[model samples]
Target: MGERILIAFNRTRERTVAAKTRVADTPASRAVGLLGRDGLGPEEGLWIVPCAMIHTVGMRFPIDVLFLDREGRVRRVISDLKPWRLSPWVWAAHSVLELAGGTLRGSVQAGDRIEFDG
Candidate 1:
């Protein structure tokens, strides 16, 4: 597990969807990202900083991925990516958000601003 935090997506019309998030900022933490976990919970997520790509080779299930820019704005979204898939490199991405499959398909979108809470 990583450092617990709170994340909220500011969607259109001031709608925000919040979730319990974790930060994977260390090399060790980023290397071991969700590799050994059974699955992510409904509101649980992992945030990897300074990452532009990801792989699910060692994962047990599918996941939703969000590529965020420096200001926490969404740059791209990969929904329900199954295990063993490779994500495309996002040059503008400053971080990556990992969550349970189907978690953000209908709630989050590209260009949405995300806010972090302690």
Candidate 2:
């Protein structure tokens, strides 16, 4: 496990997306991301650094994904991604945020700025 942080949506006027986000910056942690998890709480999330794409091969539930640039600006948004699916590669993305399904429906989007804080 890495540092725990908070994810805030800047475009939404500092609205928080995930208040308890885990950092998956290690190879081991990134490889095991959400594989055995049944589901995520509304305010929980995983932040995988240096990842432009991801798969939900062993995930049991759906999730919402945010592809962000180095500065934490969202480059793309994949909503309600189901298990066993592969997300398209985002060339400009420097990290990915995986949240509970439907979490970003009306909250975040491409071009939205995000902030990570401990």
Candidate 3:
């Protein structure tokens, strides 16, 4: 699931949601920290980008959303996204990755290559 699953888009590339896709960028995509929205935890996360907004209702915790670029490089990561709040401008980003809060563990930073389950 890491080959085609880890597909890349041009942003200029037009795509439909039925594609079961994942994005990699910041400033373009937005994510909601649905930690516990549906019994979420530090290992499980729900990411949404090109989505216009992230959903946060009845959530129980916070999560981090990592934005990436075409080369799978980290652009920036927003951590502890509180429930019921919207993220900043993420349109300039190419894709966004969501992980459980505190999942970064010092490994995440700008210019680092990201790996997706794709």
Specify the highest-lDDT model's number: 2
1 or 3, greater by TM-score:
1
Local distance difference test, each candidate: 0.85, 0.89, 0.49
Q: Which tens-of-lDDT digit does each residue in 1-118 have in candidate 1?
A: 5466876556443654547787888998899999999999888889898899999998999999989999989899999999999999999999998989987766888888877776
Q: Across residues 1-118, which tens digit of lDDT does each residue of candidate 3 receive?
A: 2313342222322321112233323343333333334544444444344332344455666666666665556677777776666666655556566656676555466656654444
Candidate number with the higher TM-score (2 or 3): 2
Comparing 2 and 3 on lDDT, the stronger one: 2
Predicted model with the maximum TM-score = 2
Residue-level error in angstroms, candidate 1, position 68: 0.3
Which digits, one per residue and each the tens of the lDDT, describe model 2 over residues 6-78?
A: 6545554578888889888889889998898899999999999889999999889999999999999999999
Which runs in model 3 stand beyond 4 Å of their true positions? 1-36, 39-41, 45-58
TM-score of each: 0.89, 0.93, 0.54
Task: Output the better candidate (1/3) by lDDT.
Answer: 1
Score candidate 3 by lDDT: 0.49
